[model samples]
Target: MPVYLDHNATAPVRPEAVRAMTDALNHVGNASSVHRFGRDARRRVEDARETVAALIGVQPGDLVFTSGGTEANNTALRGHGRTRTLVSAGEHEAVLQARPDAETVPLRSDGTVDLDALDVALAADDRPALVSVMLANNETGAINPVQQVVEIARRHGARVHCDAVQAPGKIAVDARALGVDLITVSSHKLGGPQGAGALAVLDGQSVAPLLAGGGQERKQRAGTENVPAIAGFGAAAEAALADLVRMTECAAWRDRLEAEARALCPRLQVHGAGAARLPNTSCLGLPGVRAETQVMALDLAGVAVSSGSACSSGKVHASHVLRAMGVSEDDADSAVRVSLGWTSTADDIDVFLDAWGKLVRRHGLAADAA
Candidate 1:
């Protein structure tokens, strides 16, 4: 059996979610209709909304379901009508490309956003501004200090938006505690179906709809609700909440993987090692081997991994996240991300280590010893 270690890209669907989706798929109704069938479908959607909302500590009424994380991010970043936007250099392309004109806040060497730079940038302009920062980075798994970011943005009257898609199942994500005005989350990241996601608006923050249509999602988002996917999302949220302890336990395996890899190649670079990171993620770099080469080798060895975010149409390029943290171009090109999840086991780590050890012995040691 192949060992899957790329949970940060997407996790295998949980049994609970599959059951819920299957049940909902058998139903036939439009949630917008007034008939009994419609009411039942609406109930499922609302129940999902409540569950998803609880996962992030937001009001059930505060969420507007979208197609997925990318749409949720675009809605939050673009719907606010802010003339000026500031996003961390390490953000996903959804946020970066949402407003190509947005100013970039540099990151510290540890891969967390630089709060000082954010403060200075927010103070630079008097125009209405939106500050977009992620709770946990997808590639390096570095957890940003979002509470401090909110405190800084509030001083300049800038609304804070957090792309929290990577944080729910792996870490505690409380939008209220973080004090972000808007937050984005995805279903597949938490073992749900991929087509569902949510944008939570907090403290009476109003966001204009990206899609204009009938009175759905309280007119915040317009379209017929995707009932089966929403049901699966809710079921997945509940299951993920219950599995938090197991997720945290994966940290030991992740640490061992990094430690063992370092033993094989002392020059190995673990990006974001100096910062608070998600428990299951390790961005490892073998200086002499290119990332694509490592990924391909590991795939052939029956251990799956990724060079970086899977968003980029199956291409392996130098990680922009590493580059933002001031990693050298050569090192950036050599890095691959290994993320664990609830389905991961100790044997998975062992298989990865075995494959990685051979890879280092074959391709890395000679270059390092030179």
Candidate 2:
């Protein structure tokens, strides 16, 4: 089997999630119905909510399920009645596109948001404003200084929203500790099924519905719940919660891949190396090779990796994240992202290193053995 090194893209669904979803599929009742079947279905949905909410450290009543992170982000951005929005340069497209007119905060060369720049942006505007910063970047896996962002925004009287879609199972993401008003999380990001995610709100904070249906999701969101997907999400959250204590162990795997690759190509540039990053992610630049070329070559070599965000549809564009961090377009295009996951193993790393070594040699950039 091909070594899949792109956990940041989407992880393979966990067996636990699959079983939960399949069992949910066998159920017969609209979660909105008032009968016994309906009540049972409702119980499952609520249980799932409680499970997921606990995993992210939010109150069950404060969470609202959405189709995915995109809708959750959109609800937070647009639902608040045209409030000014300021987002980091490295935020996912979900938040960036949620408000095109939203002001863009600059990033340091290492890809973390520039807090001083954020303070300036907030000061630049006097209107009721919202600040959207991510907990962890999807592309470079760089962890943002969200607590600092919160302090700055709070002093300036701005509401803070953190898109922590990539953070739940991989690190500690406490909503109360971070003290943000809103958080976005994705199920598939860890091991849950796709098509289901949530927007977590601080108590008393409200968001407008993107799709107003039949008063589902406590009227915070509408439409009947996708019980199967939601149940799967809950299962994934349970598993991820159990694994958090050991999540840092994955860093050794990421470090191994990075060190070996750099050893093979001494000039390699690992994006976000200058900042705090997730333990499972490494964004490596092969200098002269286009990211698309590297991705395609790696795929052919029985390894799967990506250029930047997996949010795109079959297109390999130069990374806007890297560009925002002041990397030249040439360097941005030459980088590829490799992310490890719960199932990643040493064998997987070996397969990746062999493939990457071949690519380095093919590009005439192989490192000299000392």
Candidate 3:
């Protein structure tokens, strides 16, 4: 069996989530109707919305359900129509894809946004500014200090938006606690079905609507509700919260994998080891071994992993995250990410470590003999 270690890309849907989604699929009614069936459907949708909101410690009315994280991010960044956007250098492509007219905030060597630098940028003339920093990095699992960043932005009179997609289920994310104007989360990253996500906005924070249609999501996201996916998302949030205790075990597995990789190849370096990180993620670099080559080798050995974020084009690229962290281009190109989740087991870790050892021996000897 292949040992799967790519939770940062997307997690497997949990059984409870699947069941909730299946049940919701059988019910029929538009969420925006006054009839009995419509009211029932609308009730289910709102109930799910409330559950999702509770998981993140926000009022149910504050959550705006969207297609997924990409849409949520777009709505958060573009909707405000701020003239300047101070986006972190290590942000996910969804935020990085903002218009060139927006300004880029270079990250510190540790992959965290430099708030002092951001303040300097925002203090010029006091125009409307938007600052977006991710709550966690997808590749390195480096957790950003969003609350601190929010404080800095707020002091400079700038609106703050956070992409908390990778932070959910691994770290605590209370929108009320973080005090950001907007936060984005994806259902798929937290063991829920894809095509379901939410953007939590504080009571007074308003953004331009991304979609305009029959009033749904309170005229915020105008479209027919994705009832099944929303139900699954709510169920998954409940299930993930129930398994918080399992995170410690997953961290042990990640540590063992890193130790074994270094034992096999002493030159291996784990990214973000000096900073706080999500316990389930590790990005490692092995000198002279290209990430794509190791990824294919691991696949052949029945141990699956990835160089970085699994791309829509199915091609491996050099990691932008590592580059922002000051890793040399060669080392960044050779990095691979291994992440764990609720379903990960010790046996899976054993399989991956054994496969990695075999590949290192085979390749290391071949290069030596030549």
| Rank order (by lDDT, best first) | 1, 2, 3
Tens digits of per-residue lDDT for model 3 on 177-263? 998888898899989999999999887677888999667887889999998899899999988877877888888888898887788
Tens digit of lDDT per residue, candidate 1, span 1-370? 9999999999999999999999999998899989999999999999999999999999998999999999999999889888899999999999999999899999999999999999998887989899999999999999999999999999999999999999999998889999999999999998999999999998777898999978899899999999999999999999999899886579999999999889888889999999999999999999979999999999999999999799999999999999999999999999999999989999999999899988988874733555
TM-score of each: 0.98, 0.98, 0.96
Error of 1 at 354 (Å): 0.4
Please state every model's RMSD to the true fold in angstroms. Answer: 1.3, 1.2, 1.9
TM-score of 3: 0.96
Model 2 TM: 0.98
lDDT of each: 0.94, 0.90, 0.85
Writing each residue's lDDT as its tens digit, candidate 2 over 96-177 gives: 8989999999999999999999999899888888999999998899999999999999888899999999998999889988
TM-score of 1: 0.98
Give me the overall lDDT of model 3. 0.85
Error of 3 at 92 (Å): 0.5
